[model samples]
Target: MIKDYVSDITFQNLSHKHMSFERVFRNIEQFMEKDPTGNFKLMFGTDSQVFSRETRFITGIVIQQERKGVWACFRKVTIPRRMTNLYERISYETTLTEEVVALFTDEKKDSLIDIVLPNIYKGASLSIEGHIDIGSGKRNKTSIFVKEMMSRINTIGLKPKIKPDSFVASSYANRFTK
Candidate 1:
């Protein structure tokens, strides 16, 4: 299920509509290069929507600086069958997000880090995170899987964020899941 969506996925943002992951990586580098002293955050997340005959899962990758603009893109995965199970859908979403997060290897991350390292004394910083749509709230159905999902992200060494704070998944990615 994972490979089906990731292997040949195309990422797109507002300016570009058809881009490979490699291109997206370069865009990230370029965005950082433009303002190396700004505090930057790189985030990955996934959200899904089930239709009558299929389910559409969208994963988004975003980089931004608070009060500044953001560079973002998403890839969609469609499953022929409907996924009625809440837990299964949520789990797969997490898996999808994790797989994308893994694409940024230590060296790749360090390259981005290196951009800001020189200006750290001036408050330049970078933080990478995995965003989960689940939130621990009375009305949030995904609250049940918070622990498991967060642990999954933690296992991969990426900081995890949930709803309200997890705009990448619940907001950005969700926008395209429809």
Candidate 2:
């Protein structure tokens, strides 16, 4: 059953008895990895404005309950200054598109309700804030800066941290690839 969820969606199946959160992350990482333009602006750009605008950042947030769990790993990929506004716009657009897709797909629609909806509130929303650095200077310091920024944003009464164990791809997701 969990394998079904892993399909198309990047995830790893750790165990049959338990769901593996790592799979979700692996998939998310893979998705972002496939993107060639992650921090290109950060590297070879001449303009400061251009540098700041095009750095990639990623972070994971979660909500946990005794009987339920919700996790979302977000990749805040920076685009060029020209594309910043469009990127933010698409950031919002992607969620809407997912909702529409879920709405149309019968099985997904039901799963969203039966599985995803119950764990998440009707209007639950989480806006994670993280920093994007162009160069690799002071990795520890940079990481702390991003984490601190993200912590300030309230996750709408959701749990602060939830980590998954392992990852295995779902059969459904595998079908599309190999």
Considering every candidate listed, which one attains the maximal lDDT?
Answer: 1
- Candidate 1 regions with alpha-carbon error over 4 angstroms: 1-7
The regions of model 2 sitting more than 4 angstroms off are 1-70, 82-106, 115-178
Q: How far off is residue 166 in model 1, in Å?
A: 0.5
RMSD of 1: 2.5
Taken over the whole model, the C-alpha lDDT of each candidate is 0.90, 0.26
Cα displacement (Å) at residue 118, model 2: 11
114 in model 2: Cα distance from truth in Å? Answer: 3.6
Winner by TM-score: 1
Clashing pairs in 2: 7-173, 8-173, 10-27, 11-23, 11-24, 12-23, 12-167, 12-168, 13-167, 13-168
65-109: candidate 2 lDDT, tens digit per residue: 222333233222234444344334323322322321232244522
Q: Residues 1-178, candidate 1: write the lDDT tens digits.
A: 7555544778887689879777889999999999899999999999999999999999999999867899999977899999999999999999889878877879889899999999999889999899999999988888999999999998998899998899999999999987
- Model 2 quality (TM-score): 0.24
Candidate 2 Cα lDDT to native: 0.26
